[model samples]
Target: MSRIPVLTPETATPAQAEIFAKTVAKFGKNPLLMSTMTNSPAMMNSYLTLFQNLTDGRFDKKLARKIGLAIGEENGCEYCISLLAAIAKLQKLTDEDIELARHGKSTDAKEEALLTFVLLLVRHKGDLTNAEVQAVKDAGWSDEDVSEVFGHLILNFLTNYFWKVARTDIDFPVLRLYDQSKIARGNH
Candidate 1:
């Protein structure tokens, strides 16, 4: 049971419906996250803006999907994990690739470096060490790439936080998230 009602195109305001329409055109469906976000027009606009910037930015679509999968796993957000998994599949990500992202790794060296930075960023709440930033840059990422990465991270943060607060219904294919800490404790 979601704490907040997930608005549909019929029930949403004109501005909210516009967001949903755009989402449907892009992802082929209006995800419940954006639907529930209609409660705050500011957040909805911000999310849409950030999403557009990242999608059109320097990162490859596949790389961005990997980063989103990593964020879902790190945050232990079931809604996000499922949503990103579906998007990743649509983006042609293999199960192997999704698994690697969940573990904060990638066969591509540059991608791995970005994932490592994101893992550290999420774990430390953005208090990245200078060396960590330097390492990401060493992997051929520019300062602009760093900024775009932050945009993606912020988007993930918003999604995860919204899920925590609103408990929106998960509309994507069901996907499970691993508890990294419990795995570290040898409990999984």
Candidate 2:
């Protein structure tokens, strides 16, 4: 059970219903996270608007999903991790790729730099040193790319914190925090 009630179209207010329509148009269905967010129409609208904008932002969907995986795992938000993993699988990321992303790693050097920076941002609460920022730039990311990653961080932070508070039921396949291999070996 969720700490927050997941609103349906039938139970939504006029504004929430309108938002649900937009969600349906964009995603074919309103996801459980968005449904639970209907408690505050303004916040939900802001989330949707930010989500729309980020989808058109500098990072491609695959990169964005990787960034989300890193952040979700760092925050230990199973809901966000599960959602990102489902999307990552749809984008054809191998299971190995998904696990690496959750660890803030990538086979691509530039992507690895970005994921490392993202984890730093999360761990330091966005108080990165100048050299830290320059390291990512040196790895071939432009200033604009760095800024966009911050946007991704903010977006993920919102959902992560929300999931922590809402205790929203995982609507996607469950993606636990630790490595399953480790768990099987009694290491986790």
Candidate 3:
């Protein structure tokens, strides 16, 4: 059970109801994360809007999902991990790559560098050293890309923190198949 009650589509306000409807329409089901967000309809709406606007057609959804999964793993947020894993799969990321990113390993150099930077940011709570920033830049990311990375980190942090606080249930199939040992060990 969730620590807080999830506001269902029936009980939600018109705005919340519409959001839920839109979610179901776009994704085929209202994600558990959306249910968690219903704790405060206004907040949920704002968050949903931000999620839709920021990620609409801007960045590579696959890369963004991988980044989110990395942050979720570092935070030990199983709910967020599962949620992003589903999104990653929709973006065509292989199961192996998803597992690897969750475990803080990526075969691709760019992915490896991105995950390393994100993990370090999470470890230090965004207090990155100049050298760390330089390393990311040296890895061929432009200053604009670096800024966008921070944006992704901030977005992931919000959702991950919500997952921790809400203790949302894992409703997605891929997330349901997560290895218990890996989760218990905080390894992924």
On lDDT, the candidate that comes out on top is: 2
Q: Residue 126 in candidate 3 has what lDDT? A: 83
Assess the local accuracy of residue 23 in candidate 3 as a C-alpha lDDT between 0 and 100.
70
lDDT tens digits, residue span 37-119, model 1 = 86777788788778888888998888988898898788867788788888889889999998999888999998999999999
Q: What global local distance difference test value does model 1 have?
A: 0.82
Off by over 4 Å in 1: 180-188
lDDT of 2 by residue, 51-151 (tens): 88999999999999999999988887888989989989999998988999999999999999999999999999889899999999999999899989988
Ranking by lDDT: 2, 1, 3
> Candidate order by TM-score, highest to lowest?
2, 1, 3
Give the C-alpha lDDT of model 3: 0.76
What is the lDDT, from 0 to 100, of the residue 14 in candidate 3?
A: 81
The whole-model lDDT of each prediction reads 0.82, 0.87, 0.76
Clashing residue pairs in candidate 2 are: none
TM-scores of the models, in the order given: 0.89, 0.92, 0.85
List, residue by residue over 1-188, the lDDT tens digit for candidate 3: 66677778777878778778767766688877777686677777777666676586445787788888888877767788888887788888999989888866688887677778888888898899999988888887777777777778767888877776776678876463244543454332
Which pairs of residues have clashing backbones in candidate 1?
A: none
- The model with the greater lDDT, 2 or 3, is 2
